[model samples]
Target: MDLKLVILFLFPVVIGSLGNLSLLCHSVFLYCSGHRSRSIDVIVRHLTVANTLFLLSRGIPQIMAAFGKQDFLNNVGCKLVFYLQVTAKGVSVSTTCMLSVFQAITISPRSCGWAELKLKAAKHIGRSVIMFWVLHMLLNIRVPIIVSDKRNNTNIMNIIDFQYCSVMISSKEKTTTFVALTLSHDILCLKLMIWSSSSMIFILYRHKKRTQHIHHSSISSRASPETRASQSILILVCTFVSFYALSSLMYVWFSLYIKAAWWLVKTSALTNAGFPTVSPFILMTREQFVCESTRKK
Candidate 1:
């Protein structure tokens, strides 16, 4: 069997797994060190948790294949794999959106619209996460309905994958319904993410611009942690836009066309899989404190 896909996917899986694990450990350490009560701590903890899910959803299966456990994921395994994969992907998207929105609210001006919103209402965040899980679970329940363990000439239409499953909607009506729902969901979520991220970018840009106008000699020479955090948020927004845009483009290409080349499939899968691999490094870049601590170790 060709091992090219496994080879191409190996680095991403290993890095994603390691990065998420480290992030989880770091979050735990922070909590133990009494940072547990901070709102940012809550966000970091959730982000770490979501990253771990992403690693398991995407990286573990590829790692298994890298070790020659290819067909081990059959039938029952497919259901579990697809369920976790979808759930994790959904969580990642939701969590990132939450992070962006949460940060935006955090930095809002006293007179800003969100000033009185009590935005991080921990109860609301928890409820939102629960609702996200429930909604995606229901939406993807049809995964098992459409996917099966094996493929045969008669059932080829229903078989989505050997390791993961999806609904096999072949009829015109079903296809139309699926396409409409998918497009609507994508448009709504992507719009919200873009708007939220762009707003943060504008706010940060204004802050940096204002800082430059003031005389450095008279002002505080030390860099504010808030400014560093803003830069980090900007990096994250750029990354989220870039990767999600690529993934969304690939999705459109696959959906709008019937003939998908082998390279296209591999590229799409690789790109989609690589997001979890790269996201942690971006987050880590913002944490100067953590990096300094690591260096001192």
Candidate 2:
């Protein structure tokens, strides 16, 4: 096994796993402490939970592979890992988009006529989360059908043949179908992300500018809880976009330019494998838990 690939896989797994745990612990602490949790907190908790599951699914198998241990996984293991990995990743992206949309409305001005609208919208947070899960489940049901744990007898043995589960793109016919569906999904996700981010940026820029103009010194006094929450969601939105863009680029490259190379598999795996690890730091940096009890010294 390549040491570099092993490192790339494990680094994100270890760090992301811990980060998600921390976020979950802190979120629970705040909720228990009666902080009157907002919609963003719920979103953060959901994102953290999904990211944690994603790390577990992707990380454990990579570790086993590095050690040349096939007994650690089987067909069932492959399917379980693939299912969690896909579902968690899709949920994470959807939640980030939801968070951005939630923030844009939360911070909208009263006179701009969106303040009342915000109250009526996203009122049912539970329903929103359920919708995300249901949609992701529907999107990823193809995993069981497409992924298989079959081996090849060729002298140039594929390392992933031992245990891998992904959308099979073997034949040209299948490739066309996969590419068309993937592009349609990507465009829809990208459109939603862009729309949400743009809305938040517009509302936030106006809010910040108006506050600055009113009292330059007061602007520095302190940020409200809502501002901090919005900032955290924005950071997540940016990170989510960056990861999605990188993954999409790799997908295009593998589909178009480098389909023959073993490196394509490695690259695709690595692209997806980074998000579980990178996301937690963004949340930590946003200091979302500062108001909670666990972080207080």
Q: Which candidate is the best by lDDT?
A: 2
Number of clashing pairs, model 2?
0
- Kindly give the number of clashing pairs for every candidate: 0, 0
Q: Candidate 1 on 70-115: residue-level lDDT in tens? A: 5656666666766766666766777777777767776666674566
Candidate 2, residue 263: how far the Cα is off, in Å: 2.5
Listed in order, each prediction's TM-score against the native is: 0.82, 0.83
Each model's lDDT: 0.64, 0.70
For candidate 1, give the lDDT of residue 93: 74
Show where candidate 1 strays beyond 4 Å: 1-3, 63-70, 119-123, 151-154, 157-169, 218-223, 257-259, 289-297
Model 1 is weakest, by summed lDDT over 10 consecutive residues, at: 158-167
Q: Which ten residues in a row have the lowest lDDT in candidate 2?
A: 151-160
Q: Cα deviation of 40 in candidate 2 (Å)? A: 1.9
